[model samples]
Target: MQYFIILTFFLYGLVFGSFFNVVGLRVPTKSLFNPKRSYCDTCERTLTWKELIPVWSFAVQKGRCRGCRQSISPLYPVMELTTGLLFAFTYYLTGFSPELMLGLLLISLIIPVTVSDIVYSRIPNRLLLFFSPFFILYRILYPLSPFYDSFIGAGFAFLLVLLIILLSKGGMGVGDLKYYTLFGFIFGFSHFLLLFFLSTLYGALAGGILMKMKKAGRKTKIPFGPYIGLAALTVFYFGEVIISWYLNLFL
Candidate 1:
């Protein structure tokens, strides 16, 4: 039964992942609701159920449009599979709790934002605005989170981000500050701090490798959204374990 439930969530997540791909592609262009249907970019053929079965369809089609035989992006199936795995893991962690629901919604929002940021080197304020209210309301209803922690997190993170921006002078963008504040709202002080640490560490490692490979130079702009989203997700899912490990190691 437990395994079945996890499988069900995985399947459900795949469906959501397909929609998330739509959101990621369309939201940035402001075509999310107007399109009303999914179509192939190359052939402009509307996809039917058979062609839109998430990862399975991509695999069967060999990642090509049926009408034009043009190659489709591997990101489609990758997004579907990643979302599916995360959904199953989240279900295993939180079961049917409110955290499970909110976490899934948060993932839906972050995935698109991450993709757009990576591609365009910009984060959409519109997307962040869309989810901010939901984050606030979730906090109010849940009431399990610390009261002052979120405020402190928002303040400290905002200031810290602003300071970094000013000191670095165009090294980071305003969108990052907005995103950092959003992270604080979702995670509060302690977890937000940890998320920041992990994100910085990951970003540093990636940047170093990229610079070494000559793929990116010193002035090359790297989008911070993906790293922040990734670190936030990591802290959200494994925060207690990470905290406990730290405690055991130190004290």
Candidate 2:
């Protein structure tokens, strides 16, 4: 029964991940609702329900569009599979609770933003706007949760980032600003700080590697949103363990 429940959530995540691929692709283009259907990006043929079976259909089609036989981007199946695994991991860590559900929801929300940012260096405002209400609801309903911490996190993130943006004369984009503040609200202040620290470390490490490889220059602008998302998700799961270790050093 436990395995069955976990499998169900995994499958459910894959289904939602498939839809998230569509949202991530379309929302950036500002065409979220007009077509109201999924289609091949290359061939433009509308995909049937049978052709839309998460990772399975891609494997069945051998990762090509049925209409045009053009190679499809592997991102679709990869995102589906990744979401499925992440959801299963969340279930393992959180078991069953409102926190479990919210953790899953946060994953779903961040995936699109991360993808969009990595691909285009632009996070869709619509995606963030859509999820913001749920953050508020999470605070109201789960009053015992770290609501105050998240509030302070959001405030600190926004003002500090805004100051940096001003000093840099637009070195930071609005999307980055909004994402940092919103994630602060979602994860609470301490976890947000932890995530921010980890994100900085990740960005620095990746940048150093790229520079060393000559794949990027000192001035190359790499997207930071994806790193932030990765750090946030990691901290969400292992935050208590990480925080305790850090505190023990001083205590």
**TM-score between model 2 and native:** 0.91
What does the lDDT come to for candidate 2?
0.85
For each candidate in the order shown, give its overall lDDT on alpha carbons. 0.86, 0.85
Go through the candidates in order and give the clash count of each: 0, 0
Cα-based lDDT at residue 116, candidate 1 = 78
* lDDT score, candidate 2, position 58: 96
**lDDT tens per residue, model 2, 63-131:** 988899999888889889988988888997789988797888788888888778877788899999999
Superposing every Cα of model 2 onto the true structure, what RMSD results?
2.0
Task: Looking at model 1, report the run of 10 residues with the lowest lDDT sum.
Answer: 141-150
Runs of candidate 2 with Cα error greater than 4 angstroms are 144-147, 169-171, 211-214
Per-residue lDDT, model 2, residue 206, is 93
